[model samples]
Target: MEMALCNIKNPNELWSLESCDELEQYGITISVCTDIFSTTILWMEADNNDGDPSVFLNHFLDTVTRIGGCPQRLMVTPSRENEHIATTQTFLRRNHTDCYAGEDSVMGGVSLRSHMWIHTCTPWKICFADLRELGHFTGKDLDKNLIQFCFLHIIQDHLEEFVGRFNKNISDHNILRSQDDGPAEDKLQAVLPEDIEVCRRRCTPRGRYPCDETLFEYWELIRTENGWEVPVDRFTALKLYLHLRNVMETCIDEEEQVTCIDEEEQETCIDEEEQETCIDEEEQETCIDEEEQETCIDEEEQETCIDEEEQETCIDEEEQETCIDEEEQETCIDEEEQETCIDEEEQETCIDEEEQETCIDEEEQETCIDEEEQETCSDEEEQVTGLLQ
Candidate 1:
């Protein structure tokens, strides 16, 4: 029923551990174990206080025990935290678990796994921040327990929602896609030519580092040899997770549905997909492509589209959508109000279509009528005569 991937009996199953800081405002941290092959977060918790290494170790031990102890192999990361990393590695080793730690085998450790955590923490932190702000968990003398009481279950719901969305979301093949002949590294080098040498040296198999070919083949062999039923695709994983959740009676509480915004007026809610991909921080924006502009037009929502190259704003007024084209100095409205226009070409003023009788055009373009049925005149040089009728 647990979100686990490693089979202790199977001698080839492996998983990796990574801890990242979360909710600094509330003194919380998160540690997660992920399936190396599937890249799914198997276990996670956010109760660690003060970034203490022992707290992570305790969680690791609890997770290991729950999963029946001692998988075929375990990889721990953020090697800078030498205390807990060393302790966890030693414990795994003592239990006959192939411990991959520090700057050892590239397959089971660090470099590749670190990328997953890069954008992962931001979304969770943002969610926590929103909850704190909305719930008014401010003030210096506020009780810590009260804050946790209000936010913990809600945050857990968000986490579970995120996990469901993340694991089930189909991955598109990008520059980071794994390949046998170093396609990922090649693509990376092509994009980041400055790090070409670093990519070559690190990506290439040498010493304790095993090639991608070896790792893939080993996993395939182990699965085939043991006849282990592993979820082959994300669809299968999603189905399995749903079934397990049902069987285990795990669900988000009804009270956790705390409204963050007014229901009637909220234009859009931050969905799980958006949270996972949202990059609002300047530091995080570096990962986004500099060449690609993020101004993607949502035609479904706006009823208008911008042709940036031609410097044109195309408005479809059938839906009564109004748009102003700044480039052409034009105003467009629905058919009902098409008469209301300001034409810069002839220095002319237009009146509302609803009251066309009120607008009188002069032969010399000297006079105009306002929407209020007042008569006004314009000089040849486009000066308002202020003639009252």
Candidate 2:
């Protein structure tokens, strides 16, 4: 996944192509320490290596193939790093390398999408195909997580190229609610200022990037068209707001249930009737959340129990040491009484050892749990509380 995102230079001149072909057999470690240098990383490493583009492309292809992902489908999203790669990538490729990158539609692609998305950051109509073929993927849990992460990626990509693919294939994206105008940019742009304002206002906090109640509210407001052939350009504002409100309520409810500290508790301040519109979805979400909270609580309890047990062990060790000290004191007294002439040096030596051992035990106890650690922990808790407040 890391390799997929990092841009590389020339896609040729990989050292292993001929060797892998020329020799049918290869060693175990040879395959393990595969040296397909990141084109991005190598570009920074001007200290060594040849300027071969062929080797670079081969390395790129090798990485993509290893990941079981298609090279053609791989495209760099709009980013400053990519802009750097755009002008300088070809130059860095050695003679043996060849960069098999796609056409440079990055800049324009990003700008248009950003403009169109300014109003509706997420568009659900694009997921029409995914909605149509939703039943094919049996693992609903995996699908749910994947869809969420994919939507996160889709929005984060900023480039419009993936929009087509997302509209066609990304299932479970029925959750995104985007508003697209008509064929004529002018026609689409003609949406009533009031209506567009309604949609844009529906997504507050500017970017609507926060994953709090605001996000839930935005997602919940997205509603399906009433008819078989859904309208593409318009949105059911009321329905969308209702969805957003539901999301906000659900987030609040789940957030409250798993609350470990009062500071982490999320407030469910949204009004009742407004949140009731999507009760079923919100309720189901609560059930899932409760189960997750139960698991988290159990894990936390286990850790707490382990810490308590460790403290108990420390306490027991201290008690045993104290008992040993009492026994030694008795022994020293018996020797002193029995041999009225017991050496003063011997008695002092024994007393000094006992005092040293007692001091050492006290130091160990201090190290285990003391005023310093408690003060630090208390200070951290106070700081966290202040932040939350």
Clashes within 3 Å, all models in order: 0, 41
Off by over 4 Å in 1: 1-14, 71-73, 79-82, 95-124, 127-145, 164-389
User: Measured by TM-score, how close is model 2 to the native structure?
Assistant: 0.16
Clashing pairs in 1: none
* Whole-model lDDT per candidate: 0.43, 0.37
lDDT of 2 by residue, 31-88 (tens): 0111122111111111001213333333333333344322222233333323332322
Best by lDDT: 1
Q: Which stretches of candidate 2 lie over 4 Å from their true place?
A: 1-281, 338-389
Provide TM-scores for the models: 0.33, 0.16
Model 1: which ten-residue window has the lowest total lDDT? 184-193
